[model samples]
Target: MSSVPIADHALLSDCRTAALVTLDGSVDWLCLPRFDAPSQFARLLDDEAGHWSIRPVERARASRRYLDDTMVLETSFRLSGAVVTLTDALATGGEDLGHGIGANSPHLLVRRLECSGGEAEVEIVFEPRPEYGLVRPVLSAVDGGIEVLGGADRMVLTSPVPMRVEEGTASVRLRLVPGRVLLFALHHSAAGRPPARVWPQGELAHRLERTAAAWRSWSELHQAYEGPWQDAVRQSGRVLQALTFQPSGAIVAAPTTSLPEGVGGERNWDYRFTWVRDASLTMDALWIAACPDEAAEFFSFLATAAGPPGEDLRLQIMFGVDGERDLTERVLPHLSGWRASSPVRVGNGAWDQHQIDVYGELLTAAHRLADYLTEIDEGTRGFLVACADAAAFHWREPDQGIWEVRGEPRHFLHSKVMCWAALDRAIDLADLLRARGRVPEWTRERDEIHREVLERGWNPEVGAFTQHYGSADLDAAALTMPITGFLPADDPRMLSTIDAVERRLTDGHGLVYRYLAPDGLPGREGAFLTCTFWLAHALALAGRTGRARAVFERALAQLNDVGLLAEEIIPSTGEHLGNFPQAFSHIGLVNAAWAISQAELPAGG
Candidate 1:
């Protein structure tokens, strides 16, 4: 099992793939070519899976931060008498290369180390494990560095210094003087194609400069969020962009798989695939973060991928980055799980689950982007009608809720409210586009859902809305009532629900649980970070500005040192759980901050 805390790792991305670099100068987890590709380094799951480390020989303390407005990470190591800084980034295609900042490039991971103080000794180790540690690659010494060959994959490591290959591993040690620099670049290819040429030290430095500049340029052009939590919102925006699959405009829930929701539990699931619900909300978050282009692109991708709604009008719950629909789940028992969280999984089984709330999310996303859209195509107009029709027909039936619970279906209040939202947005869209559709039917169904939820989904004895019809359970998802405009935040019923949720669901540390009801899963999980943020957003919308800011700050305080958040947080210990740098958590942060900012504005301003 890996010993490193999940929070100890920082992310590096080229918008095509991602690498997780630990503060101790180890690249522990990485996937080549695509976010869901098999790992090239899997030590984050198992210690012997694979890892590459470059750190000072002597013990040292380290501090790290991202470069100004960029994903480039720099870690400073302070030893007894020496200081060294290691810079890490996944190389980007800059304008200088005649491509845009988000263009895909040859898969390359770059690390530059420079000594600024007294002389220091550093050691380097490289162990390439192909197919998630299923194949141990053969390492051969090449002209500049080393070549790793295994299965159908080939990786070339080019370094300024010679590396010795021993027992399939590469090791090197060097003594560095002040102002001296050392650089290493690892290029990957799936077809065993050799690197075009070894990058010289100067060329590597130039690429680093250009990559940093590209990131800065993109931030300047895209990030327009000016809110009270400016820094947090901008950082969240960057994390969201990093999680995006640039080629397809599909935003992954998280870049990792099988990171257990609860340690030593079977609640683990792969999240690398794009969910209709997550992608739709991600589009809304991007719009609020001043990324209108991304929102539009995402909607376009969804429209094309979804094609025409089927007879049932049920869209695929999720899909691969390339829009493939077969996301079958399987377990890897060969490798020990992270921290003994067993049954490490790949793909996701929930892709086939019937999630009724997706229509609402998709339509709401399209409605949000309508202002930026120049014209509505026939395909999109038909898609909108189909979605609204699906909601109208299915809202009365029971299915999995938004949490994708693995148990029997029930009349989840959130799903019903979102069904109302689906028709609500679709009615608005139909009028805006002047498209032919059952607008009257949609309006009737929308009102019917609203009335049904108010009458049946609420528990009179509990004095609040329940998780499902006839159940008194409180759910964090009900907080979306105001967010989706299904009800006024200050409505007497909504206020009672909010107060009841705070009284029953919160952990007294500002962290909120999704729901305490069992969902065919074993073991307990941490408080969901996104749900906590939703509480803050709901509070702000209800005009409790001061309390909302406090809750928002408490949620912000749970982020890791590098301003990254995970799917959940251990409320008692504040240890991050589940997938790292979760896009949903960041989306919640951005949207919550925007809500507070809007609420704080003067009346009529």
Candidate 2:
């Protein structure tokens, strides 16, 4: 286990939830039904705690990949004289399925295995740890399978394989021949309800086929990119699709839990929750990729989450997939974090922080939605008006900025830019409304924010905009100045700012650090991957394609052997830190790829 790096894990999901399938053939981290709900198998973060894994009986070389533009994963293993394929998916609106299983249905996990050639022995393991592995569920043999009960959650396993049950888990071993297929599914139902297994084996195959077709059709809808890095862009789009929480359109930052930024360094935090900052950017990425409905879905989620008008909308930096707000931070001391990183924590405390950037994300997202809507709905427009009004009233005050550093509040420059974005987007909304005979109040607020940012945030003495007002330090986040259209990428001020950031904060690996300061936390972290892509985009937009491609290549090399990248990469050891396979990191990759691809085009076209 120690030899296998966390980056070796591949993601599988059906939009509502996700699972981490390790290269060694284990489904370690899965939160069934919803992204934030209790894990059905949580062992990825804890070695001995919660897990439901299945693999071959013997150790073997393994590889995994998505089934062509779809969220389904096919992990193949090669052992002596035999090979097997494991296909896994969240059992929801599959083949012939339009959307997903209705939210009301019990959570289901469908594992299908087929032997293509030779013969092989297989093994299956099931371990259910309730409440983050604090409770030991009582397991019993049922009519056709096994039942696990703990607290309010119940799990029923339906399979033809025989297994022994003991302690808090179960395991089974079987021999397989070519053309043999096995289906192992776990159905989660209300307490006392015998697990429901509605789909027969034949129906399961049809569901798989339909699900594959659905994803392929969706991918076809993407207009031809014809860009140089189209592969990277397409991969990023698929990742974004996997990260989206379909029922509400909320996009999670990452799918895994407790893949630490710094091993045993107390930098571990759960990232399986929706973030306005990430979601806003994801929407932008989707729009660029021609995913109109996905972009609109993000705006709808923002509208729903931000609440009606100003009601002091909860300063939620994160929320559950189902829109639950009570993400109280807690630590599980029993099981060590990834690679013995101690004190694994669940639920992000940042949710309680008074980060002001969310308002900007909300407004900017709404602005994009309104601009694209053929006919804007009154409810959504009214919600946007209320949010813009509230933002106009509180644009100047300082609190936690985008990084959510748990330190004293200050005027974070990125936060201010986002505030400016809010007003700017609102003004765009106002212009659209004026043409349509709607309200005209958004113009004043929009101009006010623009003027405020230009006046209060720029520091001429530094020859570049500072990280915040009253500070002279260069911030890597300032790279967004060009991307947001706040300033031309080639403007001397923005160029100087970029040069200053490269001089001060570049980790010497082509990746950018969030800042040079400690950020009120112990131990140093790696260069942020997302910021690196931002720098790449800024470079290309500024007519530095060679430099941009160089930096982009350096960043791309940081992806693990399996083509999966973590949130950050250590400048010294090149070790990946932070959450594994982060959506933010992928989103940045797509943006950088597209920018690099476009930069190669002739200027006239």
Candidate 3:
């Protein structure tokens, strides 16, 4: 199995697809053409799967960072008397057009090596394992680069120097002195599409420069958050932007799939698809950290992709990046999972799960985007109205909770609270949606939801709001009630819930767990990074600024050297345990920081 620590990987995106690179300069996880495509390099999952690595022949310590405000990655490898800097990026369209970043990408990954001090020797291994290493491509030395032809993808690897190509692997070693520079790139094309060609060295260098410029321009135009943890907030914004599928405006929950929640465990999942549950929360984060430039466009994609609201009043919980609705789960048994976490999965089965909170998520998002929205057409307005109506009807039903438990469904309190929020937001936007006539119907169910939650959802003996209506389990998701305005943060019940969570649901370091209750899953998972941020956000809303900052810092300190966060953290060991560079974790960081900033503002100043 691959031994590289998950935190050792850094992200590079062209806004269409994503690649994960280790500090040692290996592209271990990449799916060509799109985020959800079959992997061209899959070493992140298995040792025998494909990987392209460029590292020093001798031992060297590597230090890396994202270049300035861009997704370009620069790694410096240092030995006793030599040092070299490697710069990597997936080439964008070279400009930020009026629509989105990375539009019209060239489908290229560019790498540049510069010997800055003394002399150094490096080894490059070019391996293409198409279809997740299930097929070995035919490799031949072409004019300027090696041709990799076979399987579902065809690609060309630009080579500036001669190399030995054999058995589908290319090997070469080069010695360089100070001031010497080498440029290399991989250009990708779908099978039976255009015949892919190698890039000239000069043009490859130019495209890299252009891609960096485009990212910087997008940052300048969009990000304007000035607050506590400014650097972390801005970096999270850039991560969110990179996670977006620019062409369709849908954002994946994370870039990589099958990264385990606990090593040697079975909690692995595929997260490369967009989730309706993330809609409103992701939008809220974009507004706080990065400007929501694609708010209207994102909503449009959701509306079109989801088709009509279901007549049965339930919608799909997730969709593929291309708006494909069928996310059937299957396992690749041939490939051993990362750290031996078995049965790597490609699609998410949760796509069809009944998640009642999605309605609230989308409606709340629409209400928040009122200023940025375009003219709401009849169909779009009706779809949203149906979402509100469905939520009002379904709040009382027992369904899968936000955690998507595999066992029998329960009346999750968080779901009920979100249903309440959906009606509240829909009523607020009645005039904008031109549906003032539906207000009374929405109000009726909305109030009933409010009263029911207050009555059955809270248990006096538990001293906190329970996970389900009658259970004593306290969940980290309860933190959202205050954050979503379902209740005032300082209200007695809300304060009691917060206190119980802090005292019971947290590890020694103050990291929050989703819940202590048995989740149908076999083993336990790590403390959710997003839940920790939720605690901080709730504390901020409650005017507990000191503890808020402390909890925020507790999560912030988990960022790897590159300032990217994972889905969860192993509390005692302090290692990242779940999917790397998770969008929800970053979204939580942005919104929590914004809340703290707002709380810190002088009382009338």
Q: Which residue pairs show collisions in model 2?
A: 95-207, 95-210, 95-211, 261-578
For candidate 2, give the lDDT of residue 486.
78
Q: Write the per-residue lDDT of candidate 1 for residues 1-605, one digit (tens) a residue.
A: 98688899999988888999998999999998789999989998888889999999999999999999888999999999999899999988645222255575567888999897699999999998878889888988878878888877778898888888887789999998998888898888765555534678887888888888888877888888886989989988888888888888888989888778888787888898899898888888878775657655676677788877643588888989878889999998876877888888998988888888999988898898888664657666666677888899889988888998888988899999999999899888887646545788889999999899989988989999989999988999999999999999999999999888888887788799999987788899999989989999999999999999998999999888899998998898998899888998998999999999999999997
For TM-score, the strongest prediction is 3
lDDT tens per residue, model 3, 1-605: 98789999999999999999998999999888999999999999998889889988889999999999899999999988889889999999856543467788888999999886688899999998999889889999989889998886889999898889889899899997899789989999975667678888888888988888888888888889887899999999889888888888888998888899888888889999998877557886888787887887787788788788643478778999878998999999998999999879989888888889888888888887877775756777777888888898788888898999887889999999999999999999998778799899999999999999999999999999999988999999999999889999999999999999999998787999999899878888899999999999999999999999999999999999999999999999888977778999999999899899999999994
Where model 1 places Cα greater than 4 Å from the true spot, the runs are: 96-100, 192-197, 431-436
Model 3's lDDT to the true fold?
A: 0.88
lDDT value for candidate 2? 0.74
lDDT per residue for candidate 2 within 148-239, as digits (tens), equals 87877867787766678998677888899999887777777764655555345776676666667666666777534657666666767777
Model 3 ranges with Cα > 4 A deviation: 97-99, 191-193, 310-312
Candidate 3: count the clashes.
0
Error of 3 at 40 (Å): 0.8
Ranking by TM-score: 3, 1, 2
> Whose lDDT is higher: candidate 1's or candidate 3's?
3
Candidate 2, residue 239: lDDT: 75
